[model samples]
Target: MSSVCSTFISSSALSIKPKCANPSRSRSKLRINCTVGDVFVFSESVIEQKAVSTAEPLLVSAVRGENVERPPVWLMRQAGRYMKSYQIICEKYPSFRERSENVDLVVEISLQPWKVFKPDGVILFSDILTPLSGMNIPFDIVKGKGPVIFNPIKEAADVDKVREFVPKEYVPYVGEALTILRQEVKNEAAVLGFVGAPFTLASYVVEGGSSKHFSKIKRLAFSKPKVLHALLQKFTDSMAKYIQYQADNGAQAVQIFDSWATELSPVDFDEFSLPYLKQIVDTVKQSHPELPLILYASGSGGLLERLPSTGVDVVSLDWTVDMADGRRRLGPSVAVQGNVDPGVLFGSKDFITNRIMDTVRKAGSGKHILNLGHGIVVGTPEENVAHFFEVAKGIRY
Candidate 1:
């Protein structure tokens, strides 16, 4: 009998390979056939796995603090709504949940930008809230309104109804898609996985969707502190397991997104957000010491000093903070990613090029991954994005 693995069937990423002076820069088409007891390992098959992983991606090398010629470049939301290719797929699939939940669609959508521009990282084409359904929080991504939670969790009893996620069980398509991504990208770029931080996930569930004031969740946090902590603890536990599961399934690195964490005052962040983020980091590190964990909190200018304490390998900086200052505050131990205003992509190609230079110069080389401060905004010109990547990948020293 032939041994089987779960690589997604629709494998596509620029069949035409580009030539590079440093052959190491080109992504090899990996065949994941690492065998153990008639089973195959996804990321373990390549020589890169055997001897310091020969095909170790630039992104991986930079994250690990290795010497490198240039900062690895990829954008948050590099895939999805901004790409014409992705929007075309959305037309056919018609459901955000289905597009993300199905392995084939996930692989195809994730590769859309990769095939076109080949960024230094390929993030899984799934949402931060993707794990919610698995955790028994029913939700949907609306066309215009954004994420909706059918039943908001409040009180101790509602929190009791939540389930810890088992990614292999609930979103096996995710693992399957990731395995397919690793095979397809061939370690040319780091394959990234992401999950919502405890506070962020709790905000969506408690507030029922996107909120400007974040008043509902803040009310819960400020008034009913214990009840909120109980809910947050469940998410901390669930997301840590989710990160480990992603790594096992072939995610080269994972990012934790706390999109709403800045809503808390420093005192509140310490009380509510910091400890849980720390717990997730501690738990995952114990299990996969070599795996890299990245943490991003929007509007984190106030909290940059406190971020590195979570023990994450990388602390992603939003545009609100200057790259040099963010770098100085986070210090030399942890790697830093982003600080470019995503809005910069909308400027002239020359303008975009100049900004990249400024960011790279400030980051001071190595221990850096060049990226947009946040997800590429919708309606950004495709040609400019291509130009951004062209200029980014061409840098030396």
Candidate 2:
């Protein structure tokens, strides 16, 4: 029967194609039949099981931190600014402008990383300013300075100018991108969706872009705590809905990027950042409890102890902190990700391999995800990335 089934259906079904399955949903059963030219034969019993979908298995499994034969590897900014293919694509769409402006292009760009790296997952290819663009805040990604806000939110009135809920139209771009990604990439890689945390988002809005000291945001946090809270509340509400939109579409897991949380001390983080961040995490988790949510804060070495309390499933560390020390500080409740310096990718392959091996070893035997301390630099050597993974796969532990 099994031979008959293989003979009938194997020809048409074995061509590698992308498929998606939501573990939260009911199971899908598959049956086999053999087709010898025109003759058909049935297999044993109908295969009773969950759907045979093609979405990457490793990424989804890693989100749950399930013990796997090997650790899945992918980098921050895995989807952008590195590959020659990506540059060529951008050159083709010269006026494509910022990523959020073109959903189709954005989807294509997002898939580039997965195709080139064959990494375990694909981070969505949209900017951190994406949600703000949805809110109609005048923003643009400048060549060198990063996201430049044309309309900065300063006073209480300016806060009200932006919509409390992200516009519905903007939601589909992300969902559409995920749909396209699901169709494009082979099943071995997972698609990851991310949003900026409220504090980081608020800092951008308050400070009007990247900053040295974040003085304006700090003043707002200290002087007019209610206003800052209100802004954060608005962002938290919108961001929660935005993240949920991604999950419902096809994103296997989500991450909250709190890049500026390092700017705040522990007291300030608890007061101005943690509460709002917790709100977003709690709300999102309520709906999708099994979906892995990672909270990554750049320069957040001081707040390691405070991270688990935010209700995040994973806490990503930056390069400033030692991974072993971070492991000790974080205890064992939440999985830890990252701490490899991205700059090290510019070093010799031997140097890169040693660093990757050391980080993997130092992270010890708890729930850990290997990643760069931050996004890859624009001109990183491809060989170094290859070497990094070679070391990762070669590590015994």
Candidate No. with top TM-score: 1
* Model 2, global lDDT: 0.73
Least accurate stretch of 10 residues (summed lDDT) in model 2? 16-25
lDDT computed for candidate 1 = 0.82
Each prediction's Cα lDDT score?
0.82, 0.73
TM-score of each: 0.86, 0.82
Error of 1 at 148 (Å): 0.3
Model 1: per-residue Cα lDDT over 1-397, one tens digit each: 0011221111121122222221122264333322222111222221232223347889889999998767888989887878888888888988899998998899998988888887889999999999998999899999888999999877889999998888888989999999999998877788999999999999999999988999989888889999999999999999999999999989999999998999999999999999999999999999999899999999999989999999999999998888999889999999999979989988876567567766776788689999989989999998888767765665555
Per-residue lDDT for 1-397 in model 2, tens only?
A: 2322322223332232212222222234333433222222222321231234474466566556576544557899977677787778767765435555577788878877655456666878877777786686777777656778888787888887878665357656778878777666646567788999999999998888999999999988888888888889889999999888888877877899998987998888888889988998889889988778899998887788999999998888888999889988887778888878999999866567556656665776446778899999998987667656644543333
Residue ranges of candidate 2 with Cα displaced over 4 Å: 1-56, 94-97, 394-397
Off by over 4 Å in 1: 1-54
**Candidate 1 worst ten-residue window by lDDT:** 1-10
